[model samples]
Target: MAKFRKKPVVIEAVQYEFGMEDGFVVDGRYYDKSGPVPRAMNRIPAIKTLEGRHEISKGDWIITGIQGERYPCKPDIFAATYEAVE
Candidate 1:
């Protein structure tokens, strides 16, 4: 008998809401939208650490933390309102 292996899926981009708990909502979601806003808060900051364990720049591909997991998202699907972690 032979075993079958599944291929890895690829994502482009995703919309993310940065905040503590469930306060800031984006795309029908919520993040820590309450509290003192950071002085150096970047709505769409560059990716400092990710699955690659490296810095991510604009035009790069990424996914969203949905339901406590990273899901695949196409550039077009998320490009509309994709924000990096700050």
Candidate 2:
């Protein structure tokens, strides 16, 4: 077996937190909001991605891939995998 390395790429991401308003759109790029369930019940925030609807926990990073796909990454994994571009 041969080892492979990941190619360097820059991606756009946003850290989601509690109390972020529904229908929140940041920089006209990120469109994050609460799920259909009422916030009173404390349902996790979710977004539609290339794969499917994924729940986003607090401090999770929403990443936009090079091909314009979106997905959620846990904070710890994100920290280990990515860095500030500038």
Candidate 3:
């Protein structure tokens, strides 16, 4: 079992790359191998994606769950749905 996250977290859009390739999802997201890079995640790698939890995938915004788990969120719905919290 995993711990539940209750508070809204700050998330940012990023460019996803599997290696020598580069491209879209515009929002100017990309991966820079020169420095601190984000870990790749998928539904298989995600600790959640069950029930009402957000789905994780490629070309999605990386959101930090309440308990500090990082997961992917769809771009369009991510913009239309959640508001940034202070």
Candidate whose TM-score is highest: 2
Task: Flag clash pairs in model 1.
Answer: 19-32, 20-32, 23-31, 23-33, 24-31, 24-33
Poorly placed runs, candidate 3 (over 4 Å): 1-59
* Model 2 regions more than 4 Å off: 18-42
Q: 8, model 3: CA deviation in Å?
A: 6.5
Q: Compared with the true structure, what per-residue lDDT tens digits does model 1 show for residues 8-78?
A: 34433434433212232234322333454334433322232344222233444545443344433446655
lDDT of 3 by residue, 1-86 (tens): 99987574455444333442222221234433454445544212122333433323456666555555555667787778677665
Q: What is the C-alpha RMSD of each candidate to the true structure, in Å?
A: 11.6, 7.1, 11.3
The model with the greater lDDT, 2 or 3, is: 2
How many clashes show up per model?
A: 6, 0, 2
Worst 10 residues of 2 by lDDT: 21-30
Each candidate structure's TM-score, on Cα atoms with residue i matched to residue i, is 0.24, 0.71, 0.34
Q: Residue 12 error for model 1, in Å?
A: 8.3
In the predicted model 2, the residue pairs found to clash are none
In model 3, the Cα lDDT at residue 54 comes to 38
| Model 3: pairs clashing at backbone N, Cα or C within 3 Å | 15-29, 15-30
